[model samples]
Target: MARFTLLGTATIPGKGTELRLLQRNDEFSIKIAGSTGELMNSRLHGSEDALATLACERISELPSPRVLIGGLGMGFTLAAALKSLGSDAQVTVAELVPEVESWNRGPLGGAAGYPLEDPRARVHIGDVVELIRQSPAAFDAILLDVDNGPEGLTRKENDWLYTSAGIHAAQAALTPDGVLAYWSAGQDPAFTERLKRAGLSVEPVTVRAHRPGKGARHVIWLAW
Candidate 1:
């Protein structure tokens, strides 16, 4: 069986440790040592498209909207957001890993399609949670693909993002009628309830990929 090789490792501020970049033949992935979640993917088929679709749908209403995306990953969500929004739209991407950003600029550039070069895009190398906390009704749309799901795959600190307090903070950071979209690897009924508890109008959208035009199945929580 084929396996991934260690590409490199780097420490990120606020994230508290070194993160590893891995490659398997043509594919790339990022994981924190001793952590369970896979961060970025060069395969183009993992978490990117789903996040892109979610952002696109939310930004359809406004021209030149300001969007905030949590987690840069391989830049798939950022690329998709740029493609979907108008030229005037601005996207702020918050990524906790500095090496992931470097990888995207280096070997992962082609796979991500160089989203950072876009004039409307800005990259923040820090915790997305801090950004959300500081931002108050600032973004037209907030798209979160930070962890594997509500259960969290990497750092345990990520649990706050799925909690009632975190949901409230996210809601406070959104403009009135703005959309909050979250991508999960699988469904979580309890989290859906938590969204409702946060006073959001919640909708669960299930999508599949790897089959014809669509392959793997993904669940997206659309809340406002």
Candidate 2:
């Protein structure tokens, strides 16, 4: 059996604790035991395609829009967003772990083709939540794939992002008609309600992509 080798580690502000990047042959993994959930290659808990689809769907509506992506896991979501958005669209990816960002730029670049280096992309080595909280209604769409789900898979601090306050903060960061999308491993009715309670229109979408031709199913919560 093949095993993943420990590549490196890094710490980010606001996200808490440290993050480790692992690599096994061509596959990559990221684990932030105290921050966002564990990400194995492109399969995050269970839903990477679902989240990417949701982000792409939201970005597809705009022409040359500015977008914000919370996570850079294998660059799957980021690449999908880039593909869905127009040529003039600009994407800002905020990755908490510097090593994860480096992995994206280094060995894993071939898997996702280093989309972060696209002229339209601006990679930021910081916390996505803080970036959203600091930016004021600047993005046309904000795709959050930071944690496993609102329930969280890594740290308890991530729970704040799913709370009403977090939802409200996300809403405040979006443009008047902007979309806020969240990728979860599975469905959480309570978190769905929280989005609605945040005074935003919510749409729950399901997608499957783990198997080779999109056969695995996952849930995505789209709130605007």
Candidate 3:
């Protein structure tokens, strides 16, 4: 077995949480410094890819569609989104931690074919919520893969993204036909109901972490 090597570390601003990057041979993993679980892995990104593909498919026909992606984990979602959208579309990715972006620009990038190199991609080193609040009705789709889910396992501040107010902000940020998608480690029925209360039609999808028919199950909520 190849022993894991520590690559880099970054502290989550405001939250005081440290994020560590490690590599075992060609595979990379990101985890909270003190946690035993991985936040993201270069190899198990099927669900992340699905998050972008599924959301972009709905808005594919729109002319010059605008898409917002929260969390640039391994660049899988961004790469998947870009592939699904037309060449005229623009994708803006908001990553709370700057180092994560740097990692993508470095060796960590090859896992998703270096999505940041895509000409249509624009990186934002700030909170996704702020972007959602400011861009009212501007995006054709918003995909969020930040944290573990609506439960805020990595950062307490992430809890807001799952709140009624946050949901409404996301609702207001979308075009009339826009979609909002969220990635989770597991299903959250209450979060689905919350989307309903926010007046959005929601669909919860179960996906595999690895390629189809393998690995752990993850959930993605698509609301429009």
* Top-lDDT structure, candidate number: 3
Candidate 3 residues lying further than 4 Å off, grouped into runs, are none
Clashing pairs in 1: 209-214, 209-215, 209-216, 210-215, 210-216, 211-214, 211-215
Model 2 clash tally?
A: 1
C-alpha lDDT of all candidate models, in order: 0.82, 0.76, 0.95
Over 1-224, each residue of candidate 2 has an lDDT whose tens digit, in order, gives 79878787766555466777877777777776554544566443235545655656766766678888888878877777777777898989998777777888887777777788888888888777789889998888888887778876655666788888888888888888788888877789998888887787888977664743454466788887
Q: What's each prediction's clash count?
A: 7, 1, 0
TM-score of 1: 0.88
Which candidate leads the pack in TM-score?
Answer: 3
Q: Candidate 3 on 1-224: residue-level lDDT in tens?
A: 98889999999999899999999989999999989999988899999999999999999999999999999989999999999998999999999999999999999999899989999999999999999999989999999999899999888899899999999999999999999999999989999999999998999999999989999999999999
* TM-score of every candidate relative to the true structure: 0.88, 0.85, 0.98
Clashing pairs in 2: 208-216
Rank candidates by TM-score, best first: 3, 1, 2
lDDT of 1 by residue, 1-224 (tens): 68988878887664567788888877888777887776555664544666666756776768679999998877888988888888888999998877778888887766778989899999988889999999999998899988877988666788899999999999899888788999888899999999998888999888664323555677889898
TM-score quality measure for candidate 2: 0.85
RMSD in Å for all candidates: 2.5, 3.1, 0.7
Q: Candidate 2: misplaced stretches above 4 Å?
A: 11-18, 32-38, 43-46, 209-216
